[model samples]
Target: MDALANAPDILSATAENTRHREWRLPRRAVSWLQVLPLTAILVVLFALPTLLFLVVSFFDYDRTGIYPAFLLDSYREIFTSASTLRVYGSTLKFAAIVWAITLFLGFNIAYFLIFHVRNPKIRIIFFLLCAIPFFTSAIIRTMAWIPFLGRSGVFNQAVMGLGFTSQPLSFLLFSDFSVVIAYVHLYTLLMIGPIANSLSKIDRSLVEAARDAGASRWQIMAHVIIPLSKTGIALGSILVITQVMGDYFVVRQMSGGQSASIVSALSVEIQAMQYPPAAANAIVLVVIVALMVGCLLRIVDVRKELMK
Candidate 1:
C-alpha cells in the first residue's frame, strides 16, 4: 500500500520536470530568434557589400572595361602617387583640427548643461537650442555659411564697421578657415550629446565627498569628474573624428576648388568608371578609418563601459 502511494507521487514529479525542460528549450530559442533579424541584415547589407568591394578592388580596369584579374596596380598607384599622398595628408590634418575644436566646445557645453543648469526645463531648452540648427538640411546649413562668410557678407561688414580690419577678410570664405568653421558647426553636437550622457551618470555624492575633503573645484574635476567621464569623451572624439575624416561635401564646398578630399578624388574616379582603382581607394580609406577606431576602442573599451 505504501509503495503504490509513492509511485503516483514519483510519476507526478517526473511529469513536472519534463514540462519545465520543454518550456526552457523554447525560451532559449526565443533569445536566438530575437537576434536573428539583426544578424541577417548585417550579413546581407554590410558584410556582403564589403566582401564585394574587396574582390573588385583586386581586379584590373582599363578604358575598355574592367577585367577580372588579381592585380596590385591600383594599390601601387595609391601608395606611389604624390597627389594621393598630399590629399591624404590634408584630410588627416583637417580631421585632427576639427576633432580638437569640437572636443573643447563639446566638453565645456556639456559640463555646463549637466552640472550648472539646475532647472530641468531650462536644460531641455538649452539642448533644444543646440539641436535647432539640425532642423534644416545640412546642405542648406553649409550653403548658408558661404553668404555669411563671404567678402560682402554680414561678418565682414560687422568687422569693418567695428574697425577690426580695414579690408574684408579673404581667408574667411572658400579656404581652410571656412572648412574648419563649417566642420565645427556641424559636428560639435555629436560630441556634446555623448559627453552629456556620461556626465549625467556621475554620482553627486562622490563629488560632494571630494568637496568636503578640502579638494578644490579644479582638483575635484580633474581627479573625480574627468576620470569618470572619459568614456563619453572617447565616444565623442570617435564621432567627431569619423565625421571629419569622411567628409567630402563640406571640405569641397567650403574650401572651394582649392582642396580635394580622399572621397572627392575617389568620386572623380567613379565618375570616369574607374571601378578597380575607386574600389581600391575605398578599401584603403576603410582600413585607415578602422585602424583609428580600433585605436580608440583599445583605449576606452566602449562596450565594457556601456555594459556597466
Candidate 2:
C-alpha cells in the first residue's frame, strides 16, 4: 500500500523535473533573419510590381504615360473591341497547340533519357546539350533563327541545291509557323527538366514486373509508365502553357512585328505609353495562366506525387 502511494509521488516528481528542464533549456531554432533578405527581395521584385500593375490596370492612360485616377475604361476596351477578342482567341489557340506539342515531345525525350540510356555519362552529356541553349542570351538565339530562315539563308540554299524548289519559301519566315517553331526550340529544355526529374523517381522494377507478367511493351508503357508519369505531364503542361502565353520576345522576333501575340500586343501598348491598357492586358494574361495552373492542380496532386 505504501509503495503504491509513493508511486504517484515519484511520477509527479519526474514530471515536475521534466518541466523544469524544458523551461531552463535554450530553444535552438532556425533563424528567420536568414530568410528575411529573400522575403524582402520577393516583396520588392515580384509582389510590389504585381500589385502596382493590378492597380494601374484600373486607371486611364493619357499621352504622357500617366494615368487618370479611374477604373473600368481599360477593361471595357479590352472586352468590347472585336480585334482584342480575336487576339485573345488566337492566343488561346496558340497556347493549346504549344502545350500539346511540348507534352508529347518532352515525355518522349524524358522517357528515352530515363529508360533507354543506361550510360550515365552519355545521359549527362545529352541533358547538358538541352541546357546549353539557356546559357546564351535569348535575343541572340532568336536572332540566329532569322538568318537561317531568311530568303537567302542556308535552309533556302539547301532546298535549292536539292532541286526541291526553284524559289525560297516565303511561308518559312515572318509567320505563325515560325513563331511556333521558335517557341518549341526555346521551351523544349524547360519541358525536359521537369519530365526528367519525375521520370528519375520511378522504380525500374515496376516496369520489369509488368513485362514479366506477360504484358507487351505497348501495354507496359501505356498502363504502367504513363500513369506513373502523370505528374511530369502535368508539370510540363503548366510550364509550357504559362511560358507560351506570356512570351513576347520569341513571338515578336519570329513574327517580325508583322503579327501580334497577346504579349506582343501588350508590349505595343506599353511602348506607346498606354500603361492602363498594357496593365489590363497583363491582368488578362495572369488570369488565363492562373486558370491553367488551377486546372492542373485539380487534375494532379503534384506535391504528393513529388513526395513519392
- Give candidates' CA RMSD values in order: 8.8, 9.9
Deviating ranges (above 4 Å) for candidate 2? 1-36, 65-70
**Distance (Å) between predicted and true CA of 193, model 2?**
1.2
Q: Write the per-residue lDDT of candidate 2 for residues 1-308, one digit (tens) a residue.
A: 99965755565555556765673332221124335567899999999999899999998667866655868888989999988888888778878888778888898999899889999999999999888988998778878878898889889989999999999987888888888888888787778888888888889899889989999999998999888888888888888888888887777788877667798889889888889889988998898889889999889999898887
* Poorest 10 consecutive residues by lDDT, candidate 2: 23-32
What are the per-residue Cα lDDT tens digits for candidate 1 across 180-260?
A: 999999889999999999999999999999999999999999999998999999999999998877887888899998989
Model 1: lDDT of residue 176: 95
Q: Model 2 residue 105 lDDT?
A: 87
TM-score, cand. 1 vs. native = 0.91
